[model samples]
Structures are given as C-alpha cells and as structure tokens.
Target: MPPIIDPTKCTGCGVCVDVCSEDVFFGSKKGKVPVVTYPEFCVHFNCCAYECPEEGAIKVRIPLPLQLLYKGGDR
Candidate 1:
C-alpha cells in the first residue's frame, strides 16, 4: 500500500520526503507540497505518516490482500 497525502492538512514541511526510505514521495523544488510519485515502491512501513508533523496529513491504507493476513484483536 502507498501513502496518501492530504493536501489540505500537509504543510509541505518535507519531513515525509526526508523520512521515506523507499523514495516514494517527491517534494517540489519550489516548496510546494510533496507527492507520492512511486506508489509501487512503498513498503507500507508508514514512515511518512509517522514523520508528518500535521495530524491526518498522511493516510496509509493497508492493501486488502495484506489486510486479510492479520487478524484484528479486541483489547
């Protein structure tokens, strides 16, 4: 799964671009918001979301095939 960035919430801080090891995100040279340029490169580690300073700025949805592999737990 790839990281989905919310333009409204993103501050274009470049943190996500900096933190992504897979080079999935691309930050604009003109200081515009970054984009997920390579979705297939994403490993679904969610480093982008965790690095985002703005809440709800990045949403990483697990792929349906992978989602079925892990069972939910009730705490």
Candidate 2:
C-alpha cells in the first residue's frame, strides 16, 4: 500500500515528492498535497513517512505478513 498523506499536517512543501524514489507523487504540485499516483509500485520503503517534516503527516502501513518477515527496528 502507498503512504497516506494527512492533508491537515502537510504543508505542500514537496519534500516527500523529492525524497521518494518510487515516483508515487509524480503529478502533485508545489502547493498541494501529494497524490498517490502508482500504488501498485509502492515498495513500502517508509522513506516518505520518515522524511516528512510535519509529525503525523505521512503514514505507511506495512502489511502484517511483511512486518513478520522483516523483523526490523526492534530495540
């Protein structure tokens, strides 16, 4: 699944668009919330969510199966 951008928090800075390698927000404009253009191409990289300047702006949910397989970020 693609990352969900919270319109309430997003400043339309286009940082997410620049950081994402998947071109998920290809058509989004400079002063508008990004659009999830190609959901099927999403790799669940979590880069967009991590790089978002505003807290709670971007949320990327990893499927349960993939969560179990990766076993990362455990501290």
Instruction: List candidate 2 segments past 4 Å from native.
Output: 63-75
Q: How much lDDT does candidate 1 score?
A: 0.78
Model 1 ranges with Cα > 4 A deviation: 70-75
Best by TM-score: 2
Instruction: Mark the 10 consecutive residues where model 2 has the least summed lDDT.
Output: 63-72
Clashes of each: 0, 0
lDDT of residue 52 for candidate 2? 86
TM-score of 2: 0.79
- How displaced is residue 59 in candidate 2, in Å? 0.6
TM-score against native, each model: 0.78, 0.79
| Tens digit of per-residue lDDT, candidate 2, span 2-61 | 688889999999998998898888888998999989876778888888888999999987
